[model samples]
Structure formats: C-alpha cells, structure tokens
Target: MSRLLVTGGAGFIGSNFVHHVMEHSDDEVVVLDKMTYAGNAASLEGLPESRFTFVRGDICDRELVDRLVSGVDAVVHFAAESHNDNSLANPEPFITTNLYGTFALLEAVRKHDVRYHHISTDEVYGDLELDDPEKFHETTPYKPSSPYSASKAGSDLLVRAWARSFGVRATLSNCSNNYGPRQHVEKFIPRQITNVIDGIRPKLYGQGLNVRDWIHVDDHNAAVLLILERGEIGQTYLIGANGEQDNKTVIEKILTLMGQPADAYDHVNDRPGHDMRYAIDASRLREELGWEPTYKDFDAGLAATVEWYRANEGWWRPQKAAVEAKYAAQGQ
Candidate 1:
C-alpha cells in the first residue's frame, strides 16, 4: 500500500480528503496539520489508527517538511490560510503559509524526488462578470483579487517551476467552491446553516448576486484521487461540477429547506473587493481522465449538507460565536 502524506489534514477539505482515502483505498495516510482555528482534530474522529497517523506541525517548518517528505510515497499539499475575510484583515499569515510554506514543501519534495499534488482554488483566476457565459478553464490567466487568492496563485506557480526546473513529479488541481460536512462555521454555507440553528437570521452579502460554482467536497476529493493516480505530471486540472448558484438563491434554498421563510435572512455589507462570480470549466479533467462528479444535483447535495449540520450541532456550535463576532466587527 502507498503511504500518502496529507498536509492540513485537520482542516475542512483536507480532513474530508483523508476520509475519502480511507473509505475508498487501502493506502495508509499520514496527516500533518497545524490545527488552526479552521482545523478541527475531532473531524478525524473514529478513523482507524492502524491506517491513519496524525502529525501536529507546520508546513513552513523546513526541517519537519523534509523529514516527512522523505518517508511518503506522495505528498498532497493542502495546508494554507484560506479565508478571504481573515486574509483581508491580516495578509501576513496567508503570505507566510500559502507562499513560504509551499516553497518549503516544494524544496523537500524536489530533494526527495517524491510525487506531489498541489490543491488550489479557482479564485486564482479572479472573478467573472455576472452576465458572462465564460467559465474558468485550466488555461485561464492568473488575476487574483485578494491576498488569499494571490498567495495561492503564487504557490501554484512554485509547483510549476519546481516541476520543470527540478523534475519534481507534481500535478495540480484548482477546484471551485466546496460544501459538505465538517466545514468550519466561518464559511458562507456553514455560517448561514449555523445561524439558522441558533435562531438568528442568515446574513447575505450585498444584494446576494455574487455567484459561486459549488461542488461537493466528496466530488472534489474523488477528482483529486483520479488526478493523483492517472493524471500526467506537470499538468493542471480544473475540478468543477457546474453547480452554479447566486448567493441569494443559495440562502433562499437554505431557508426554505430549514423550515423558514425564503426571505427571512438579512442583507449585510459586502466584503471589500468581493468578486462578482466564479465558474469552472473542468472539461480537461472530465474528458481526459474520465472523472465525473457523483454529486451533480446541487439541490440534493445542499439538502444533504443542511441535514448534516442540523444533526451535528455540537461539531459547529463551539466556533459559531467567535466567527459571527468577527464578522460583526467587520460590519459584514
């Protein structure tokens, strides 16, 4: 069995990917996580100890990264300071973790000749006009609008440079918005879901016209596995399920599904420099790799997500107060 090292394994997408690996494969996994506010150790609960091992550390620690890279058959790099609001408040951590940390891992993997995959976001391509029919493809030009996206874009470039200059066997995937279980309450979907649970009005940004191309975390992870196993080295793939919905519609659906009035939510000030929309064109991944999303029905997937939050209040409640308090301070 291959031994895979998953950085940021305690965080939302990383933790979901770990679960995906365990459920679908015989591969052993080593999770290296820094346990930030978004990283919840409990998310990895009940995983078999024989197949899973957790390491508490930072990816920026070059010595530690070198040691870990030397042992793994491949490295799936997922560690990053990923929140746009948090990055706007303080861009330093995003630069440090997303850029410097990625540099450190790239160096280690290059030295060890380990296979690598970099997990990134489509925000790296900036936003599209609300009326535009074009979606972001693998060939989209980089035009990041926020510190978070800029840092991620920088990290993606590093992987490319390393793959070409040092012959590091690496692949990359830029995925659209993801929603599923174990997501931190600070994110859009979970924040609204948890607010409803606490008898508070869900807050919408601006007129709630900004669009996101949603994909289930499981579908994203499934595509990642396909890319890691069969994708050509040095190629970048875009992963999306074409589940596009405006902020208004998403919140309304959530309200309706949760037994509340569709217009029950409140409108708050939008974040500065908010992108109007993000859509992904994942044709390369689909046609070349033969990968398809199981969670293609957005409404059904979203309903399932709502049910997960309703039943797992204890998992998200502890982080709700602080997240809302932070948003309140920003007038968002």
Candidate 2:
C-alpha cells in the first residue's frame, strides 16, 4: 500500500478526497493541515485512527514538509486560501500559502523523489467572455482575474517548473466548483442552505449571473485518484461534471430542493471582478484515463447536501458562528 501525504487534507475538498482515497484504496494517509478557520479537524471526525493520521502544521514549513515528503510515495497538494472575497480583502495570505507554500511542498517532493499531484481550480482561466461557454481545456491559457485565482495560477506554474527543472514526477488536475458534505458553510451553496433553514435570506451577488460547473466532492475525488494512478507524468488534466449552472440558478435550485420560495433570497452588491463564468472540459481525462463523473445531476446531490446540513447542525453551527463573528468584526 502506498503511504501518501495530503496537504490541506482537513478542508472541504481535501477532506472529501481523504475519505474517498481511504475508502477506495488501502493507502495510509497523513493529513497536514494548519486547521485554519477554513480547515477543521472535525470534518474527519470518527475516521479510523489506523487508516488516517492528522498533522497540525503549515505547508510553508520547509523542514516539516521535507520530513513529511521523505517517506510518502506521493503528495497531493490541496491547501489554499480559496475564497474570492477574502482574497480581495487580504491577498497576502493567498500569496504566501497558495504560492510559497506550494513551492515549499514542491521542494520537499523533489528532494524525496515522490510523485506529486497538484489540485487546482478553473478560475485560473478567468471569466469566460465568449457567448457559448465551451468547456475549459487543459491547454487553456492562465488568465486569472482575482487574487485567489492568480495565486493558484502561480502555484500551478511552479509545479510545471519543478517537473522540468528537478525531474520531479508531477501531474495536475484543475476541477470545477465542488459541493458536498462537510463543506464549510461560508461557501455559497452551504450558506444558502443554512440561511434558508435559519429563516434568513440567501444572499446573491451581481444578478447571480456568474456561471459555475458544479461537481460533487465524491466525483472530484474519484477523478483525482484516476489522475494519480493513470495520468501521464508532467501532463495537465481537467476534471469536471460538465454540469453548468449559474449562481442564481443554483440558488433557485436549492430553494426548490429545500421547499423554500425564490423570494426568500436577498440580492447584494456583486463581488468586484467576479468571474462571469467558469466551465471545464473533461475530454482529456475521459479519453485518456476513462474517468467519468457520476454526479452530473446537481439536484440530487444538492438536496442530499442540504439534508446533511439539516441533520448535522452540531457539526457546522460552531464553525458557522465563528466565521460569521469574524465577518461581523470586520464590518463585512
């Protein structure tokens, strides 16, 4: 069995990936996360201690990273400050964690001679200007608009550079937006679910026209494993459900699923430089690795997600209150 290191393994996607990897393989996982406000250890609650190990640390610590990478067969880099609004409010943490921390992990992986899998986002391609939203391909140029996406773009480049310069076997997968269980409630989908349940208005921005391809976390996790196992070294793959839904549409869908009315939403000022759309082309992943998304229908998955929140208020209430308190203190 391969011993793997998963950075940011406590966050939403990372946490889901960890569960997916463990369930599908006999691998031992070492999760390195700082447990930042976004990174909560509770996500992995009740996981068998023998199958998983949690390390409270930052990816930027080169010494710790080197030691962690030394014995692992592979490393999956998933740690990042991923919110656009927060990135706009403060970009420094995004640069430091997303870019420099990624560099540190690359250095460690290079020294250890381990395979590296870098998880990335579709935002690196920036907003889509074309009328017909063709899926974003692996060859799409990096034209990130927000500080968050820009930082991720910089990290992606570093991964490529490390492979060319140091001969580190590395693969990349940029996926569309993900929603599933254990996601931090501050995200759009979860926020909407929680708000409607708590008798508050779901907030929308900019007419909610921004389009995103939604994928369930489980499907994204499966695609990541496919890339790690069958993807060509030094190649970039794009993973998606090909399920494109706009922000407003997604909110309305949630309302319908939760049996709430559309009038319950409160439209707010748009986020500055919000990407009008993000879509991904998964043709390469499908043709090359035979990886296909199973959760293409957002309604079922979204309804399940809302139910998860309803059933696990204890899991998210503290986190939700803390995040809200932080924003309230900032007068956001």
Candidate 3:
C-alpha cells in the first residue's frame, strides 16, 4: 500500500481527494494543511484513524515539509491561495504559497526522489473569447490574467523545471472549476448556493456572461488519482467534464432549484480582470489515461450540491456572514 502526503488536504478539493483515496484505495494518507481560512478541520472528520493523519503545518516550512516528504511514497501538492478575489485583494499570499510553497516541496521531493504530482488550475491559460470554439489543450500557451492565475502559472513552471533539471519523478494536472460538498462559501458555486440557503439574494458579477467549465470535485479528484497512477512522469494532463455554463444561468439554476424565482438574483460590479470563459479539452487525459468524469450532468450535480448545503447548514453557516461581508465591501 502507498503512503501519500496530501498538502492542502483539508481544503475543498483536497479534502474530497483524501476521502476518495480512503474509500477507493489501500493508501494511507498524511494531510499537511495550514488550517487557513479556507481549510476546515471538520471536513476531514470521521476518517479512519489508522489510515489517516492530519498535520497542521505550512507548506512553506521547509524543515517540516522535508520531514513529511521523507516519510511518504508520494506527494500530491494541492496547497495554494486559490480564491481569485482574495488574490486581487492581496497577492502576497499567492506568491508565498503557490510559488514558494511549491518550490519547497519540489526541493524536498528532488532530494528524496519521491513521486510527486502537482495540482493546478486552468486559469493559467487565461480566457477564451465567448465565441471562440477552442478549448485549453495540454500545449496551450500560458496567458494568466489575474494574480492568482499568474502565481499558479509560476508554480506549474517550477514543477516542470524541477522534473527536467533535477530529474524529479513528477507529473502535473490542470483542472477546470470544481463544485461539490465541503466547498468554502467564498467560492462561486457555494457562494450562490449558501446565499440562497440563508435567505439572501444571490449576487452575480456584471452581466454574468463569463462562463466556467465546471466539473464535480469527485471527478477532479478521480482524475488526479488516475494521473498519479498511470500517467508518465514529466507530463501534464488537463482534467475537465465539458460542463460549461454562464454565471447568470448557474445562479438562476440555483434559485430555481431552491424554490426561489428564476430571476431572484442581483447583478453587481464585476471584479477586475475577470476572464470571459474557460473551457478545457481533456482528450489527452481521457485518451491516454482512460479517465472520464462520472458527473456528466451539470444540473444533476448542482441539485445534489444544493441538497448538501441545505443539509449541512452548520458546516457552511459559520463562514457565511463573513464571506458575504467581504463581497459586499467590494461591491460585488
């Protein structure tokens, strides 16, 4: 059985991945998380004590990272300053965590020659025009439009360089937008879902014309596992499920699903450098690694996600007011 080190495993997608591994594999997982505002300890609750261990620590801590890296057979690097709005407000954390943290992990893995997988975002490709018929491919050129994306783009490059320069055993995957349970209220899908749950009108950015290629968090995690197992080192895979929907349509769907009027949402100021659309072409991952997303129906996934928040009010309620307050302050 493999012993895996999962950085940011307490955060949304990382936590989902931890659970996925527990449920599907014999792998023992060590979760290294900073317990930041986005990382919730409760999300990792009820994991088997024998198979799961949570380490509250920073990825930027080279000593702690080295110690952890030495004990695991593989390192799945997921820690990052992920929120675009927050990155716009403060870019320093993005640089520290996404860039420096990755460098630290790369150094540790290079020293030990451990198998490593880097988790990244499709935002590194910037955005495609709304009418553009193309999607982001593995060979797409980097054109990040925001601080968060730029920092992630920098981290991706670091992994590539480490793999080539030092011969670190590593692979990378850039996934599209993810939506599922345990997501923080600050994220787009969860923000809208929890706002409706709390009797607040959902807020949309500008005309809400920007589109995101959505995938279930479970599907994204599944792809990560497949890449880590079957993928060749020094390669990058794009993970997506072809679930694209505009913001307005998504918010309206949430409203209608929650028994509110279809038009019961507000259009607010848009954030600076908001990308118009993000689409992914995962043909390489699918064709090469035999990976495919099970959550193909977008509406079905949304309904299930809405149901999760409705049933887990205590989980999301604690962060609702503060998240909405921050957005309100930005006039978003």
TM-score of 1: 0.99
Off by over 4 Å in 1: none
Please list the C-alpha lDDT of all candidates, in the order they appear.
0.95, 0.89, 0.95
* Candidate 1 structure quality by residue, lDDT tens digits, 114-213: 9999999999999999899899999999999999999999999999999999899999999999999999999999999889989999999999999999
For model 3, the superposed segments whose C-alpha errors exceed 4 Å read none
Model 3 poorest 10 in a row by lDDT: 323-332
CA RMSD for every model? Answer: 0.6, 1.4, 0.6
Candidate 1 overall lDDT versus native = 0.95
Ten residues in sequence with the least summed lDDT for candidate 1:
323-332
The TM-scores of all predictions, comma-separated, are 0.99, 0.97, 0.99
lDDT per residue for candidate 2 within 110-189, as digits (tens), equals 88799999999999998685376466898888999999999999999999999999998999999999999989988989
TM-score of 2: 0.97
Cα lDDT tens digits for candidate 3, 1-332: 99999999999999999999999999999999999999998899999999999999999999999999999999999999999888888999999999999999999999998999999999999999999999999999999999999999999999999999999999999999999999999999999988887788889999999999999999999999999999999999999999999999999999999999999999899889999999999999999988989999999999999999989998888898898888888887
